[model samples]
Target: MKKYIVVALLCLTGLVQAQEALFSGQQVSSPQVNDDKTVTFRLSAPQADTVQVTGDFLPSVKVDTPMGKVDGPGKALLTKNEEGVWSFTTSVLAPELYSYAFIVDGFKTTDPANPFLIRDVASVTNIFIVSGKQADLYRVQDVPHGTVASRWYDAKTLGFDRKISIYTPPGYESSTAEYPVLYLLHGAGGDEEAWLSLGRTAQIMDNLIAQGKAEPMIVVMPNGNVGQDAAPGAGSDGYYTPQFMTPETMNGKYEAQFKDIISFVESNYRIKADKAHRAIAGLSMGGYHSLHISRYYPNTFDYVGLFSAAIMAREDKSGAGVYDNFEETLETQKDNGYQLYWIAIGKTDFLYEANEEYRAMLDKMDMPYEYTESEGGHIWRNWRVYLSEFVPLLFED
Candidate 1:
């Protein structure tokens, strides 16, 4: 009994020591949002030769890559203090959600002090929001929030069970009325969770509905990659690295199987299952899907949105599937269109010229569409703005 008592005392003493060490005053607090609207990032790298911080909030620099010249996040060197701490303070930054990373001795890494993080493609970085007019809708405000559910449905067309993310509006649970559905799609290297996590879909929808800016509607987000069941680590092929371009992407496979998603959504949810109450929109590769899917079904979706879309015809014009017979299908879609067709792209986006050509084609065909041109290139910032603008215009009487 005495031996057991001694062992227990030793274990308790070790635990208390660990607690004290964890709670010690040596903790580093990073990404301090100052009152002056400037932000400070700190790292306690005592033996590091050099330290630097790079983020989207800073001015971008043009960097040349194998793909081409592109705008990259700017890096700021951190000054070392007498205590071996390295830190950097930025100037007054615009109100927005920003992501950043630290470079310690040329090694890119996340901030250990910052618990909040988001992954885009394969890169993971810490994120922070600067509260202001533009960023307010992105934050979770004191409003009636909606319910987001991860659902599994059998994709009979693809011969597999797929995962989807659904967002029902604030009053969907108690309300007996059927609601319109907006099918939201993500860009390349993104999954169904892209809009929920990175695009701030819930916050935007909740705030918009609470303020009476948008009508209550259901949102369906499904994985566009036909070869994958879900995002990395979330699928049966567990723990694989996510790539920018996955298999079966933009090969007309996903577009052909899209009806499976709609069929599932309509069958399971209390949705107004008609062309008038349905809408589809996406960014980048998703934009390509939206464009093709809306046209392939002709009289299906009344509203179609393409944000920073890849607008080009495929090499095979043999009228095989969604990619083939593009002009003919688009013309048919235009003739059968019931409501709005929205197209938006950034001025600096690589797809700008292609969008201009598509718009010209539309002009030739006398197809009507609302166009919005933003300042930045292909990015989440512009996509979020496009989504916020497009939702308000949807399901309007």
Candidate 2:
């Protein structure tokens, strides 16, 4: 017992030292919240060199806008406090989710003392969730809601263990009947976690369900990319294609992950496991997949959604996806069965032209679809809006 006590003391001492290292020379400890909804951060490197903070999540703000401050609503001051220790104070920063690392003398490192963080293995980044006045679509409401299941599944056809995230809607737990499934996909470089973390899809469903705009349904987000599908013709050197993925390759995967996600969601979720109740949707690459998969199977899905969809049909290119003939594929699907083909894209998204062209092609082919052009770019704002409007229209007569 004495030995254990000594060890605990040592750990506590080390923790205190680390904490001191982080909080050193700061004018204010925790950044003060401002009335305008922002927080400021301060950093000082007076004696030695310059100081800057960078993070995986920090997008470039407008000029003159200080760190942690949204639109420069808050202010931070950096000045010399002592011989070497500098004092820095920041203006308020907007809260939602943010990650940052202190760049002392040009060295970037995470604050060791701060506990708030999100992990992706070896690397750790700070995250802050500030309450926003904007309505939250995913917040649990009075209506029954389902939980998100994060798991891995094997893809037999493509040959990979895909990480999958499925959001089962409210009333799923107690309902005697199974719910319909919507296989959702994420964009480039994003895995299954993208939709839940950034998209707030489940919350969007919750708000809509509570308001009676959308029926409760399951949403599955699968990874897209056989191997980082980049600018289509950037050259075969980095091109992620159908043949690129074999049973052995693991580091960069796409097709295999998608196949497994679908199979896993069907088996695991108490879903209406048939073609009539099944749907597919995604943004960017995921949108491309939805177009391909629905067109290929046709009868497998009853509803299809594409947000800022990357549906670039290459006539000469053979192995971008499972579909062989794009025209015949859609024709056969239209013949076999059709569902709600709803596609929404931002006016500024790179895929906007493709979306419009796809719509025109659909019109020529007499393929029924619902197309929406909203005000925004290919970002989360448009995605959220698209989801908010689209969900209520699902599973409807």
Candidate 3:
């Protein structure tokens, strides 16, 4: 018995030593931000023949257009040293949040050294913030932050219980204030968690409200997928299936069911339930939904914003048409005394042409609206900028 115990102890010691040597703290010091504002990335891939870094800092070559460039962070190849560590240094990056991944011989993966990550609908990548001036807006500052709750509510329009993320201002819990509401919707393939995670909605709101740039209001982020009750894996429904990609699920269902979300919010929260205090805005599919919802119920929302919206003027076979009596709808909406009808899109966004067509229609109808164009493509970077700009302009008399 004594001999067997000794042998077992020796084996356990060897295992611990092997793990310590393999994951020594040296390899964990990757993604170090240099004093010059440039960044150095390292990976301890002793056997990897080739490793490359791809991120938003790399410049992207446009594929769809001739003589144009797609917006990207830029890519760089790493150099391996005698110690079997691959390293690469970047030029001074701009002050903002950036996501990146390392490709080892062809297999893409997040940095093991960096645990901070952002998961989108289709992919997951590591994230880092290069902070200084305006980039501070994206960072969590030393301010009284608001509370973000993932609350479940009944969606009678869809006949299932659904979840929505709501952000109440800092004083909401303590103060007896009835605040305005902003129905902030997410894009396709996203859920209630998307805006809070990748979009940094809470950080932006906290910073903006602290700086007095935006009013203290409640922001509701609802799951826009009509076929699914919550984010994939959050409920019994597994990952989103392909059958829900039809036009019926995409166009009409969400708009028809949105009233339930509003009713839930009004009944549960201390919100000023009036058109003048209600706002709706979304990105991509959510933008399309916002457009239709505001149009379908013209008096429901006083502020409407479309961020890189996928607008189609034609009628859908699914009975979710946008342009059926579109001129009359716009005329009636204009007569309803809305506070703001805003549209923002990136210059390199693939949906730029669609937004232009919508703008042209609005111009032809002589409708009053605000248009903003920024630098970048159809990425979260531009959407964040648009939100920052749009929130400040909301609820201001």
- Estimated TM-score per prediction? 0.93, 0.68, 0.92
Kindly list the per-residue Cα lDDT of model 2 for residues 261-369, writing each as its tens digit. Answer: 5667768777778887877888766777678777766677788889988775433222445546779879988887666889998765656677788899989999888
Residue-by-residue lDDT tens digits, candidate 3, 233-328:
786667654332433545566776778999999999999999999999999888988898898788999999999997864344334454476678
- Superposed model 3: Cα runs more than 4 Å off: 1-6, 62-74, 238-248, 313-323
Badly placed stretches (over 4 Å) of model 2 are 1-19, 22-33, 42-135, 138-145, 225-261, 314-321
The weakest ten consecutive residues by lDDT in model 2 span 65-74
> Between the candidate structures 1 and 3, which one is better when assessed by lDDT?
1
Indicate the residue-level lDDT of 217 in model 1: 99
TM-score between candidate 1 and the true structure: 0.93
- Ranking the candidates on lDDT from highest down gives 1, 3, 2
For residues 1-397, write the lDDT of model 1, one tens digit per residue.
Answer: 9999999999999999999756542487789999888999999888899999998888877777433565678999999999887989999988888999999999999998898999998989999988897788899999999999999989887799999999999989998989999999999899989999889999999999999999999999999888889889999999989988886667777887888899999999999999999999999888988998898899999999999998774543223466767789888998886699999999988788889999999999898999999988877888888989999999999
Give me the runs in candidate 1 sitting further than 4 Å from their true place.
Answer: 1-26, 63-68, 315-320
Model 1 clash pairs? none
Model 1 CA lDDT for position 15: 100
Q: Superposing all C-alpha atoms, what RMSD in Å does each candidate have to the true structure?
A: 2.8, 8.3, 3.0
- CA lDDT of 356 in candidate 3? 95
Clashing pairs in 3: 56-73, 57-73, 57-74, 58-73, 58-74, 58-75, 59-74
Task: Report every candidate's CA lDDT.
Answer: 0.89, 0.61, 0.85
